[model samples]
Structures are given as C-alpha cells and as structure tokens.
Target: MRFQNLMFLAGASALALSNVANASDLTAAEAVQEARRAAAERTAATEGQEIVVTATRSAQPLADAPATMSVVTGTELRRRPVQDLAEALENEPGIVINGIGMTRRGISIRGMSNEHLLTLIDGRRINDALANMAHADFDLGWVPSVAIERIEVVRGPLSALYGSEALAGVVNVITRRPSERLEASGLGLLGLRDGKGGDTGQLSALIGGSITPSLGVVAWGEYRHRRRTQSPLSPRESELEAREALSGSIIGWWEPAQGHRIEIGQAAIDDDRARDTVTTGARPVYYEYQDHITRAQTHGSYTGSVGWGELQARAYRSVLERVNERDQNQTPTQPTKATDTVFDGRLTVNVFAGNRLTVGGEHRHETLRDSTVNTAGKADVNHNALFVQDEWALRDGVSLTLGSRFDHHPAYGWQTSPRAYLVVEPIEGLKLRGGVGKAFKAPSLKQLSLGYITVAAGGRFIITGNPDLEPETNTAYELGGTYYGRSWNLGATLFQNDLDGLVQTNCVEFCGVRGRERRAYVNVDEARVRGIEVSGQVTPLPALSLSASYTYVEPRDRSKDRELAERPNHSANVKLAWQVADATEFNVRGRYTGKQTIYQADVPVRLDDYNLWSVDVSHDLTRQLTLKLGVDNLFKKRLAESSALYSFAEPGRVFFAGMGANF
Candidate 1:
C-alpha cells in the first residue's frame, strides 16, 4: 500500500512538471536553477551555523560554552514529528518531561525539580506568580512549533545572570525572524493508533518579505485539528480531545545609523475551547479552558570600538499577560490571572588583551490576583539584582571565568551568588571544563501569603504561614568534556549539587488541637544530588544516523539517608534515522526510565521502571509540500511520569499525522 501511494505521488508530480513545461516560458535549465536557488534558501533557513545562544546572558558558541548546553533547531524539532516543548526535550540527556493532561506539566533537569529551572522566550523571563512558586507550564497548547526558530537548554546553575529562580538552568526559546525574500510554506499530518486513538490534520501558511530594505515583516499561522480518546485509567476517561491555536508575529529591525540597531516585535496566541478529561467517576469528566496571551518587546543596542576594546550596551522591556478560565458543568467559580513586567539593561567590553568584562542589572515586578469561593489571595513581589563577570585568558588554550551577583528582594534581604569556571584545551576537538557555583531561590508569594485551612487529625482544620522563610541555597561543582570529529560527536559530564536551607513543609501533629497536624515551612538540614551524563551521535552512512544518551543520578537526603522523590536512578534514549529515498525518511526511537522512590511524610514509595518506543516517517511531495506520520508510546506504557503526589498520568499510546506546504 505504501509503495502504491508513492507511485501515485510520483505520477502526479510528473503531470505537474509537464504542465509547468507547457505553460511556462522558462527552459529546463532555468527551472533547475530556480529550484536550486529555492533549495539553497531553504537550506540556509533550516540548516545554518549553530546558533550562538545567550543562555549565559552572553552570546557564545554552544560547543565552546563551558557549561553544558543543547540546541534544538526548528528543523530538528520537525524531524521528531512532535508538538510541545516538553515532548521535544524528552530525548535530551539529563532532562525528564512530566505530562499533566497534555497541557499542564513541568520538566526536571539533572535531578532538580521543575520549579528549579527558569524558562525564557526571546530573552524575556516567563513568570508564574502562583503561591507554590512553580514556573507555569510551557503552554505547548498555544505555542506554535512552526514559529519556533530554535531552542537552547543550558544546564547547571545560572543565578549569576538570571537572578533568583534560576537555581537549575535556563531554557531559552528563539522565535523565527523574517527573511529578505518573499515566500510561503505549510505542513500537515494524518495517522491512526492501536490502543487509544488516531488523528489527521494539515497546516499551510505563507511568510517572509521586506516592505523596504530597512523594514522587514514575516507572518505565518497554523490550523490543526485532531481527534483522540482518553486512556481508560486517565484522570479523564475516554473522550475526544480537540486542540486548536492560532499565532502570528511581526518583527522590525531598524539600523538608523552606523554601529547601532533597534528591534521591536509583538506576538499573540489564542487557544479556543481545549477539552480534557478530569475523572470524577467511571465515566470521564470533561473541562474546557480558554487561554490567551500576548507579548511585546522592544530592544536597542549600540556597538562601537572604544580605545583598545569593543563596547556594547543593550536595554529592553517586556510584558506578559496570561489569563485562563475554567468551565466545569457551566459553573465558573474560580478564575486565575497574572501579569508580569521586566526591565533589563546590560553593558560589556572586550579588551585587546583577550579579557572580556560584563556588567548588568535587572528589575522585575509582578502582581497576581486569584478568586475562589472561600479563598481569595493577592500578592506582589519585587526583585532587583546586579552582576558582573570577567573572562581572563591566563595562557594559550586556557581561560578562567569569575562572576558574582547581588540580589535584593522585598521579603528576603541581601543575598549573593558567585561562580567560577576554568577551560583547558590540550588538543583539537577536545575540551576540559570545570566549574563551581552558588545559586539561590527566594520564597514564593504562595509560600508567604498562603492562608488556607487544611484538615488536620480528627477532621480538625488549621491555617499556616511562614513569614520568616529564608531563600533556598545550593552549591554545585561540575567537570565535563566535549569531543567532536567529522562523523561523530560525543560529550560527557559529572556533576554534584549540595543543597542547604531547602524549603519544605513539615507536619507537627502534637501542635494542633484534637491530635491534628500543622504544616509549616522549615529548612532541610542537607540534601545532595550527583549525576553523570553521556551523549553522542554518529553518522556512519550518508542516509543513516544513530544517536544515544544516558544519565545516571543518585539523589539523597543526607540527614535521613533516603532517596529524593521522583529522582530516577537511570535513564537512556536511543534513536535511529534512515533516508529511504530523496523524498522519504524513517525514524525509530526508544527510551528507558529506571525505578525511583517517592518520599512523602517521611515515607517512601517505590515505582517500577518502564520503557517506551515511537516511530515516525516523512515524505516530501514537492518543493513546497511535505507529509509526516508518527506514533508516540507505541506500547501504551502505563508508567508514571511524575510522583503520585500530583495525581497526573502519562499519555498512552497515540497516533498523529500531519502535512505541510510552502509557496
């Protein structure tokens, strides 16, 4: 059947070629040139030099970066045939994805909790002002993968640059920029599943072109529709799920004079009537959510040679408003809303002596409002920070980086984070890197203003709050190396983090009346996490590629001799890709997650290990058209992606197919 379909596509292409020959004045040679030019442009857009991510808040080569970082281009993301940021990062080493009904969840890196990491879009922070201090989920439901140009994942401590809440790392998403030429493109998918469901869809669009040499604009949008049934044991029982989102952006660059440039851009996303199952009985309960967000930013930078070095200055402001409403049985009792504003500025100079110096400061203020029957909470937070870093080349192929940041919060007084790194390259294609750093996370407003009544022993109710909670702190060290050659790339790293003053809730049964319990925030004496990660990719044949990654982690509470909750001991992923022909390709992927213990109320619960497999195939029907088919969780693994404390389940086996076109 596949071969027959291929034949039909070939015959249709031939017919289209004949028509073009009969109707166009261009010769075969001219047509071939035009195709080559178009291919060249696509290649430039899809596969160019590795993007220098500002993950450190400083632009640097991903490979040359002293810290561990991974780059996933828009082209690479499409190859995997998955939508959503968490899905895209699942295969990356040292990263774990948690799914909450497909739309809400978090990601853990290097054994750290999801809330430990910070997420940013185009250098602007995405703030979640909830009481728990957790960063909001990536909201993949509204993020259009088609508009993503690339994603950068920087592992390890980054508090020196990003301030509080960056104790784990940073994930920066870069959006697509307009091209100089006029162009249009689209894509779609269709497929079926064995265990749960199937789906079919298409995405078509146009983009690129400059109104004038100084001003450029690009606009693209996607419309996708899929039908699938919820898993039998899912929080929501069997029900059809529908997801639709529309997104578009405009970017303008102005080079008003020499050595200076100004950029302004705005993006808007709207998701309508997203449905999900929330189990209330044998039959699945349904809920609908309407989410919308709009973001706008303007930045200006000036660069020029001054004296014996290059000087650069940059300043920008960004605003984000996220509103979500829930409808359960046509009754909207609770509505949540949040707004964030940030102002940032930085300056740097590169000296002729090969020393790079940087200094910057940022101020962020946030306000959150929530209304629920019996519960109403409002809070505001202000954070101000200043940092400076110096990169010194002590000798040939050897360099050292030293940095420190001072942060002041309205609730927490002065705090300092410091870092040091050394890099030595004794030979080509090999680098030795080591670093030590201190990072911290301030108490979230939810932790400060939390005034909710909870049932204690004997059904007694009690309220709790910790206005004196201190910020959590961590000290970490890492050693790593990277080796790259013509046909293979490999990297390995060993890291350790020591946590102090870890904020956790403790239950004191005797303190409450009627033998009830009172929960309050207290610092954990000590905790530690050590891990090693290895990743590599090898292309032995022109049409075949092999890639693999593995991570081993040991996380423990030093005071109790117990493993941390939801910290996997071992994880691995293997993937194989083959180009069947000029216009066709196939991929197979598998992942394994080892067992881990979940700790609650000082008790431990064990979870079993599990594995999952997936397959994807794509075909290019024409210069401007493509098709993709994929099945995720081929075996419908019923493993838990998160601790049972969250009451969320991983998605079961499902199928997806889509197509795309360009003009």
Candidate 2:
C-alpha cells in the first residue's frame, strides 16, 4: 500500500491500456493524474497495448479499468510455455484449472471455489492452501516460474478494499522487482512426454544490483523436478506422483534519506510428493505415499512522505507446514498439520483534490494439527481486521469508490463490509462501471476447534467444534462495460452473489450426552449466484492478436434447491497471438466448459462438457535469449464421467520445450 503519487481522479483514467513496466499504486496526486491520463492516451488511435496497473490501485488503461482483471506479462511470463499459476491461468477469463487428471489441485473463480479466492504475494496474505480432510488444493502447484513479474486476476468482491477472502477475487502474484542497473537472470527447463517416465525439470535464478548508493539487493531461486505427469493419467498413469520443489527469495533495500524508503524480505518454500507402490487387498499389498510442505516468510516495508499525503507501511511473518506420510499397508499414520500467521498494515492519503484515502489493518493466526485424531484437541484461529478506502472525484466524466471493512472473529463476532464503485464516461471511447460489495468467510480452525470421536455401527460418531459458528456472507453486484476502439477492445460484465450463513458439517443424533452422534459446524442456510461476462480484444494486423471470453453462471443452492457443488455453468475463452517473423512467435488457446453438478451419496450427479486446447511457439535466441514450444491438452480432453465423488483425469496430450537467459 504505497500509492506514491501521480494525479488523475477525474474519470480516474478509465483504465484501458497503454504501456507500463512496474511502479504504480499511485499517490503523488495519483501519479500526477496518471501522467496526464497517459499523455491524453497517447493522442489516441490505439497506441498499442501495455498500460495496465492492477485495475485501480492507481495506473489505469486496460480501457480505464472496469475491474475484471487479468494480466500475465513478465513478457508473458517469459514467453509462456506455461508452468504453474494454473498453467498461466488456463486461458484466463473466469479461470478454471480444477482438474480432471492433468493434476491441478485447485483453481476456480467467477464460479467460486478455491476457498473463494484471495492469494497475494507482494501485497501480503500467504497460506498456500493447507490440505487436509481431503481439501486437496496444492495452491498453484510450485509457483516460481522464473520468479514471476506479473499475474493479477481480480474479479468481483474486493471486500471493500480487500478483506476476508475477497469473496472470490484477487490473485496477485507479481514478483521480480529490484534491478537498478546491475541485473542477472537464468532459466533451465527440461520436459518430455510419451517415451516413458514423462520427465520434468526446471531451475531459476535472478539477482539484483546496487550495494551502496543507498543500499539494495535482491535474489531469487527456484528448483523443480518431476518424473512423471506431463499430462497423462489413467489409474495412476504409470506410477504418477513423484514431484519436488524448492523456492527462495531475498530482498533488501534502504534509503536513509530522500522521500524515504525501506524494505526487507525473506521467503522459502519446499514441497515434495511421491506415490507408487499401489496394490493392496488380497495380500498384494504395497500402497505408498509421502508429502511434505514447508513455507517461511518474513517481511517489512515502508515508504515515506508524511506531513499529510503519501506513506505506506507493511509487516509480515509467516510459516506454513504440512507433512503427511501414508503406507497403511501395515502401519503408517500420524502426520498432518497446518499452520498460519500474518500481520499487516497500510495507510494512504491525499485528502483533497479528488480525494484519496486508504487505511488498513489485519491480524491472523491459525493452526490445525491432526495425528489421526485422539479425541481431536487443539485447533486454533484468531483474526482481526479494519479497513477503509475512498477515492472521490465526482466531476469530469465522474469517478467514485468507497470502502469499508471490519472483521473480528472468535467464532464470528463481527463482520461489516461494504463497497461502492462507479465510473462514467458518457462518450469518448465509452466506459461505464458499477460495483456493490461485501464479503466474508471465516470459521476454519477446524470449524472452530473440532474434536473427534468415532465408533460407528449406529452410534458413537461425536465430532465437535462450532463455538456458535457464523460468518459466510457475500453480497455482491456488478455491472460493467467498456469499449476502446482504434484497434479493438470490448468488455462486459454483470454479476451477482448472495450467500449467507453457509457453513455445513451436520449431525445431531440424540443431542450429545451419551447418545453421541452430534457432529458440528453448522449454519449453511442460503445461497445464490448469478453471472454473465463477455470480453474481447482484437488487433487485426501489425502482427495479429485476438482474445475472447464468455461466461454465464447461475450457481444456486438457496437452501438445497439445486446446483452449486462443482460449479461450471458455461465458460469460454479463446486467445491467439502472432508475430511470426523477426524473432518469431505464435500462440493459441481455447477453453470451454459447461455441465456440472455433484452429490454422490445423496444422488444428483452430472458432469460432462469439456474442451481445452493450447499451443505456443516462440523464438528470440538472441538479445537475451528465449525459445519455447508447447502443447497442453491440445484436444486430448478427458473426463468421460466418473462419480462416487469425482475423478476426471484431464491432462494428457503433452509436449513442451523452453529456454531462457538474460543479464
């Protein structure tokens, strides 16, 4: 939360596109009104794309930002041959990436899921999906694809300025910073398909400069290995599940004077997976498993300029741990844990002229420890929040954005969220936006401190926890439209959300006291969702580029009246890129989904509808080096029905190649 300064509050630069390379979160008078609305949009006529600053944390373009974000860059993540971030957002727009088999542990936006979004990297919030009780969300697999430099998602509910799970929005990856003159880079990758044992390997590196002139330093590291799974899965596709990951980060910066600035960072990650020996029963035993995850982070930040305008602050410390080992062939249990810790702070100001304001606060602490139950004891959760925002300017084509936040849980004690946004632009290049928000979701810590007890056969079952659970809200609404001609651009949006008190975990039998049977975690009363989105992009000549998107959702569940388990009510996305000459390049993408419904033991099941395609080609073996080739799914599509819970297997057609270098 720095928002240095730029300017621009009238029509808030109605975001669209222009050309930018880092640095934004405006402040100095909204970066001097976004450098005079990007020099009056470079005298019009399309000015060839590039200016996109995370919807409106300042910088705008991307058709003056209508808040349905998407961005990849880092030069399209270094020439895209995707790897992580759900395969670079599986063709963007309304995201999916859940899994049929190609092994995507999770991803689901617009249609919800993935714990209702909210993942940030340089904007804090970290917890890399804690898997247990079969939640199975590997959180974008092993990130670190050359230390990203872009990947912002944002769609719906910003919890008035980001609070609670953002209700289903916010992705924010944004790595790669620090490089004031001296710089370094590296990338090594290897992948192969068919020919047995798939194969996958990668290594990454980055370093930054400056040693005195005010002190500065930066570093990055990544390591990955895979011995199988480059798409292809069939009842464990030849011993599937052999993976390894290692990650690193280091940052330091200081400025003992001038406008003042400071930063500190540390990051670490280690993930491992292995599985093979499968057989069991009739004495053919074996069955194996291994999983280990560790995460550690430390942070510090501060941007100066007090006396009344620009100022930013941040603080962080995090640790996430997970370990699971399974053999069960004879004996092998014990090892399942989840941990979390966070603290944040933010402040921004302008207070006049178009009015700018922001305030922040957050605290989180969580823990989950399972050794396969022991009457289940010890589970924790503690969270607190406070937020505010404002960005006036009700004249010149209009502009507005209000905010609110107040969380405080202890088994749901306070909630309060609010939001509002509006942008006009009655003519010139069209643009109209709207917003209404509120978000919530809290009640983990094993559903408020769970405790178990089992026995079965007709009694005994006793789960636990639910210190009076509550906290599930959501109340969203959005409307959008954008148009930016000259070359082409179009967008549309209409959203709805209305959830409330949802929690779930049932059971009551004889009401406790000896008769046992009383499970826990309740409050699942209502639900509703609605959606419609459309997007477009075009650039007929000068090297080609076209994009498309469509979405129509209707997730319902108003107290069990229907749909909502696995979402998917229709989705689409298409992409194409070309520049096939000097240095060469080509890209293609396609996605479609529809039909989905779940409920195994209680009936209702229906799943079908699929389509996925991908292709990437690139070259630039000089001026810093780059080469890429790709294919993912490319028509191998999967998911021919499988229930009793789920299993779709979609990840087969595989082929890839990559190379990189820089200095």
Clashes of 1: 20
Cα error, residue 415 of model 2, in Å, equals: 2.8
Question: What is the alpha-carbon lDDT of model 1 when measured against the actual structure?
Answer: 0.64
> Candidate 1: lDDT of 308?
47
Q: What do the candidate models score in CA lDDT, each in turn?
A: 0.64, 0.66
TM-score of every prediction relative to native: 0.82, 0.31
Off by over 4 Å in 1: 1-49, 99-103, 129-142, 190-192, 195-206, 222-231, 234-244, 271-333, 371-377, 450-464, 508-518, 600-602, 640-648
Error of 1 at 299 (Å): 7.3
Measured with C-alpha atoms, the lDDT of residue 149 in candidate 1 is 77
